[model samples]
Target: MEKQHSFWEREEWLKPPDLMIIGGGIVGASTAIFYKKRFPKHDVILVDKGIAPEGASTRNAGFACIGSVSEHLADLAVSGGETVFSRIVRRWNGLQLLRETCGDEVMDYQNTGGYEIFTDEKIYETCAGKIPWFNQKLKERLGLEDVYSEREYEGYPAIFNRVEGAINSGKLMRFLHERFTESGVRTWWNSRVERVEPGSVMFENGFQINPKKTVIAVNGFVQRLVNLPVKPARGFVFVTKPIPGLKWKGTFHFDEGYVYFRNIGERLLLGGGRNVAKEEETTDQFGTNQKIKEYLTRFANVTLNLPEKWEIDVEWSGIMGMTDNKEPVLQEVKPGLWAAAGLSGMGIAIGMQLAKELVSKLED
Candidate 1:
């Protein structure tokens, strides 16, 4: 005898879709939204392995940045000048797309600006030396002059990027989910996609879905689903309770953009120091490193000068996919199994634009 199936489950929920998107983060969600807008009548469904939109999209520091000076220089060395410039353009344009799609008020986007500081004199001089060239290049790309400015704050030497800002990452992800759903795309939450082939996905719950097109948007967890030229880089973050007078009011980066901290309206959110444990930080596991966590804590106390008695309100880890080239992969991994991985820690900055590019490449 055949297993019982409800009418709603057979005709609606379990029905195969024209397009299936794996991993419901910013990229996956935005892809569904864009693809539906292009083909309004197409049936699209997005599924994520977790209950919530995990990964770096909802876990990022909420920075709307186009790479810091040293970060750009580093990428240029690894990925070359042209590629770095183009990546910067994508990230910049992606932020615009995100803002326009979600609206500023909904995401709580703050144009508070960002600053990069250095504690090492050698490193400071190295990055500061590239200020002129970076300003010129960024100006050419962004239509803005004097993008990078040198300044000092609270005994820290820093370079301020006027165009860079921060947003509420949680709110942004919520907005993406709501907006995509409103665009007529269905979503399957807590659905674990265990494996994928050319046209189908196998969920761990013993269910299968065959889609005409499947796009794997799982950034860091790509290894779990398929073989891709990407590796997971884990990061840990902590937010403190509301302090009386938290002077830091904007986003900040240090030590080659690995360390970041910002004020969330009197409460301080800080993370990074993966460099302190690069070997251990390479895993995709969602947990904090003791050494790295302790380092950041000390930095908070000694350098950040947070009141010694302030308590940590919350803390967690996020996994991000990074490629050796520091470039995102938006290629057709298999015949009809296209994938977008390796955002290289810039997922929040470039995920939407990458989705747009990927959607445009598809045949309607």
Candidate 2:
């Protein structure tokens, strides 16, 4: 079929915007929202490749949390205490900002709290030992005392985080889209950006416009657009049919946040087996790995102790942008072209806050 464009459509495509944002995921949407707030009168447009904000934004497990107890301790080992604590603070603050920005009701946010469970006694004991130190260190940053408490949950030894929560990712993204629409910011969904330049955005459909400034927030799809220190790590998430007598509630993590699950109503949503098949799961392609899926299936029943015979209702995958250091990769690649990608599966926690920081730098 021939590509169709009305007279007005052609005019709209040809006109230059004051700011052009590529990608419409949480980071891109957040960037546009922040841009408009900074320059309301200026023309800012968001172009998304999918029908809506695609990739991880609309396709994550919906945990509005940062690192769990063991995960934070492991991070401290790798990046040291200062770097790890600073990141945790940013992620904690980001979740609050998102809750405040989108409002708790519309985003379906639940501060029902979160927990990190461990099957291994050794790891559990190590993590439990750090609770006091972590609580004391983090209290000064997050201003919330007693952040982590060692306890038993659902028959498993777990470390509970008082402030961690979950949010409906769809609702949160919709809230952002609505904010942009209500604020008169133009959004172009189904627009595939081919390349990004200092002041120009070229689409796969042969549409090109030279906006005064451009921001690339494409996340996992960043390789084609820029030479950033990032790569794709695919993740799978599956939901179970409502099981009778479901006892689990609130967000959970195991194996240092690699495996996570939570209750959506009476049903269970579980995901994360990238650690099982690291090489196979490191692609931008969107498909579930068989080994990973099988591992998660057994994990749900055996490890999580969920009732057997509970059928999976749906299964899907998302590509996450990751860096070696696992921190968000934000850089001004060129004079007027900036790229903010590599959220390292922390998009829900850090995407918006990164955009806020990016905009401040953009204005500078």
Alpha carbon deviation, residue 125, candidate 1 (Å) = 2.1
Q: What TM-score quantifies how close candidate 1 is to the native fold?
A: 0.96
**Deviation in angstroms for 32 in model 2?**
1.1
Clashing pairs in 1: none
Mark the regions of model 2 whose C-alpha exceeds 4 Å error after superposition: 1-13
lDDT of 2 by residue, 158-241 (tens): 999888888898888888989988888888889899988888789998877898889999999899889998999999999999
Worst 10 residues of 1 by lDDT: 70-79
Query: What lDDT is obtained when candidate 2 is compared to the true structure?
Result: 0.89
What lDDT tens digits, residue by residue, belong to model 1 across residues 1-364? 7577799998988888889999988899889889988999999999987889888898888888887888887777777889988888888888998889888898888888788987777888889899999889878987879988898878889889888888998988888888778888888889988999988899997788788889999999999999999999998999999999888889998877888999999999999899999989998889979999899999999888887698899999999999988888888877778899999888778899899999998776
